[model samples]
Target: MLYDRIGVGYAHGRRTDPRWLAPIVAALGDARTVLDVGAGTGSYEPLDRTVVAVEPSAEMIRQRPPGAAPVLRAVAEALPVRSGAVDAVLALLTVHHWPDWRLGLAELRRVAPLRVVLAYDTRRHADFWLVREYVPEIARLELSRPSAEQIAEELGADEVVPLPVPWDFADGVFPAHWRRPRAYLDERVRRSCSALAQAPPAAVERGMARLRADLDSGRWEREHADLLAAPEWDAGFRLLVSRR
Candidate 1:
């Protein structure tokens, strides 16, 4: 799988962004038991709850910290747990990676009474400046991934919370560094973001060269300086909350 190949160092750049945690935790409500589907490195698995993580990538599972939640090597389409076995289930920024998202979502609904997913609305990908200017290929790839609305409809989501990306967001997802364009130049940053890792090397190189030039020439700053003062920006991320 793509994750098993590039997910070795995922934990280094994929820590939970505390700013976004509030909404996730709140959406989790008072659930006592939770299943973390596609739980890469156990990021965002609530410590307060009994979290059994479901991860398909052994490399990603190996990267989980020592004290992280216990994990089961399984895919979201077929959870080992029985129907309605957990209070809640979480699929954080992972729905797009599922080979069978519809089946995976069905498994989530079957395994728990409540479902929470942090997913991107691909329709809004073009609105992001980085995708628009630097890496148009990311947008092309995003077309294959289901949009947030599609996922919400599949899950019968009662609420879709907008997960605004703070200027200095801690998580290293592709859009997390929107306000800090220079972060894209860092190899470790790109390594952790699936978009850049999966993109054609030639395309990535071309985008990076343009980005580097823009930064060096102050054109990037001049064009996006307004973002520096903004507290946060909406990058089409949404927290889909549903109950069976």
Candidate 2:
């Protein structure tokens, strides 16, 4: 319901970054049949696999390209598929949005022997320049969701792989624009990030005003000069893989 409102233009900024694809596909391994839970716009769905998607937002589902995976309107806590129906289940950057992430993890475990989740460590992500300096409220909001470690523990994960955000990462998620500060100034980019979209408007407005002033006055550049030389930084994203 929340996404149906904010997800209107999701496809515009939520394209897949190839850097993430290699690791995700590798985690999937030999799984021929894959279930993509909370699959928004069908990004990162392997084209060679037999993929079925489950998404709650009609707006997001509608934006799926014409030949993308067939999807069912369903929640992660209640997947429609039978037990062990697929070789693997993929939940990408969507677990935080679930009302009950524990129940959703249970459902993911029930449906497949292999589970792959893309999640973040709230503490680390909260330190990002955008969240730390600009929108501190987003950090408070992140505190309410399960962290990457917690999700990995619940899923009995075999591995928790760090996913460093490349400077030019294509996906416009919250931390994707760490190097490109200007990206956050765009209203459309902010709308695509659920954290920015859901954060209090007054807080966001105040933060943006300060950010704009800093950018115009060259203060941002002077403060974050070190970041400009880095090719990638860990924005706390992790790929949790469970093999049962």
**Best of the candidates, TM-score:** 2
lDDT of 2 by residue, 23-76 (tens): 999999999999999998999999998999999999999999999999999999
TM-score, cand. 2: 0.98
lDDT of 1 by residue, 115-217 (tens): 9999988867755787789888888888889999999999999999998888888899888898889899988998899988888889889999999999999
Per-residue lDDT of 190 in model 2: 94
Candidate achieving the largest lDDT:
2
Each model's lDDT: 0.89, 0.93
Clashing pairs for predicted structure model 2, backbone only: none
**Residue 173's lDDT in candidate 1:** 86
Predicted structure 1, TM vs. truth: 0.97
lDDT of 1 at 187: 84
TM-score of each: 0.97, 0.98
lDDT of 2 at 214: 96
